[model samples]
Target chain A: MKGVGPTTPAASQPPLLEKEGRSSRGAVRAEVLLWLAQRASAAVLGIAVLIHLATMSYAVRGGISAAEILARTRGSLGWLLFYGVFVLAVAVHVPIGLRTIAQEWAGWRGAGLDVIVVAIAFALLALGWRAVWAVCA
Target chain B: MNRAWRARNHPAYWAFLVHRLSGLALAVFLPAHFLVLGQALRGEAGLEGALRWTDSPLVKVAEIAIVVLLAAHLTGGVRMLALEFLPWRDWQKSLAALAAGATVLFGLAFALALVGGG
Candidate 1:
């Protein structure tokens, strides 16, 4: 929001005052909710990632094949739930992180950027859940 | 340049850099990972082909790197959560060290596991 492009100054108003009014309450609320969701998802991901890492490391130690992995994961309701939650958390997490990075690094901000990120989040959820289904369902 | 060098020497700064870099790397990797796993929807043959390709030594090394990145990001994230939710304290400075140590430990464990160490 800081580096958003130049604004037109009204005849009676100062430039800084015009810029300050650009940030709508809805945008602020949405930004706050996005921040909160990222933090909450981060907490869930902290535990989920540990379990994922440990399990994958253990599995790979014995040199697991794809068929073998499928055999274990396929039709397991527990794994389905585990990975489903993982994918969901990732969906909620990554886009928000990327949004911040885009703002800082790419100078991309505002509703257009927000829309793109939400689209990305949905794409992640779809792809991730599809993978989870392929592996576990 | 002096300022940059001085910043690099700080543990908190290093942690911040590592967290940001690792996170960016993981974000870049995620799309590719999802695309590959999309092969799973094509049934066993497609998924198995992708899995077999990952069996190559190069990919194995990359996998280890990914795990290291993941560990670093995870510990870094935990440190952030603590900073946000926990009460302020002098001990917070030590979190960077703790995160680095934990990341290293995870990397070591994964490397050893891959080598078939007990």
Candidate 2:
């Protein structure tokens, strides 16, 4: 510690490790889990998006009636499951996306970040489910 | 300078270039898609008219090509992101290859589905 005096450049810089305190293990775990969720949701989106696009192209070009499309979708466990998973992925994916946006654009974090993102997720879920129900039911 | 150049010219760099191009392509297609669909909200004649436009061979080929490009860009992006952010750097090459292969196979399948099978 002799050479690491106050005047030394390294000493003047903030310590990478605080002398007595560190982030809790739980915080580190939470950060890692968020990272994993973002990655997994992205993978889901990649596949879902393609299917969504292909289906859109077909439905539009094939001149399928809304009634016909609904007939295919309604009470079909498969469509429900697919879009259900799509909504869930959006829920997880959008929050993590907003995390970056909040950090960069709003310089925000902590509880405020979690609250706003959760609200977006819920809104997406409610709206998405309503639409799905109208068509599928 | 040579080290910097090598990094800039890496396969990762090429992938980044392709992703940006494909994203731009998708952005261009999105508005056109919406406009076409907007026809549906007008009435049945408008909706069928939109379909008539879509059924053109040129439009079919263009749309299918865009889908393929978008798939390539998306899966390639995820592969790059995983390589950079995940703790699985060793598998980056293999994973990238897998993503590329999957994109080609799936894109073709979906394209064929567009024409109601090959």
Candidate 3:
């Protein structure tokens, strides 16, 4: 009964080890989730880029003016959604990729770098969505 | 100089350089692209004036270069994805060649589209 008591030394040791193990595991999990999110966004961007380029190529063939392009795009819910998704994917994809480049090429790291990238992502999302709304809405 | 010379001849190194440079170029270009699109908010006359400016020969050539950069970045991205997700194999070494080939083909297709049929 003494060994089973709350004051026993054996019972106290596992919690410390468990806490340390959980912290490391959590860090790994967060890193992994960021990696996966970037990859998923990249896949979406690959398809979106193709569609965007193909549409632009076709649209430019007859030398369509901006007004004509806007007329076709405006009030078109399909184009609105297409560009919305494209902007969202770009917002998610670019910052994370840039974070890697910053770390590798520029030797930037830590929370300050992360905050900078997140700010850039928001800026991209704002600018991109504004442009999409102007053209499509 | 020697390191640069060796890197120039290495396909994977070239792929890496293209991917990084194209990404940087596209990042710089996006603000301008968004600004042009923003012209749509100014009504037809405003947008038309901007569009007309883009009709210059220099702009046309720049457009082609932009397409090539986009294509190179995209193919390089795909190569990175494959390397990250796929199981390691001897065929992985050939991915640089494949990506480069695809990027060149994309550039050619865009050029043909721009030039129109003879």
The lDDT leader among the candidates is 1
Model 2 TM-score on chain A? 0.75
- lDDT of each residue in A1-137, candidate 1, tens digit only: 54344453444466666677665665688889999999999988998999998988788776756787788888999999999999999999999999998999899978799899999999989989988998888
Backbone clash pairs for candidate 2 read none
lDDT scores in order: 0.86, 0.67, 0.84
Winner on lDDT between 1 and 3 is 1
- Which candidate ranks first by TM-score, i.e. highest? 1
Whichever of 1 and 3 has more TM-score, that candidate is 1
Q: What is the C-alpha lDDT profile of model 3 across A3-87, one tens digit per residue?
A: 8966788777888989989998987897798899888998999999999878777777757587679878999999999999998
True contacts kept of 3: 0.47
**What fraction of the correct interface contacts does each predicted structure contain?**
0.51, 0.04, 0.47
lDDT of 1 by residue, B1-118 (tens): 6987976787777788888889889988987888787787788888888888777889989988999999999999999889889998876569998998999999989988876744
Model 1 lDDT, full chain set: 0.86
Backbone-clash count (model 3): 0
Candidate 1 global TM-score: 0.87
TM-score of each: 0.87, 0.54, 0.84
lDDT of 3 by residue, B15-113 (tens): 888899898888778878878787878887767877897778798889889998999999999999888788977764599889888888887777777
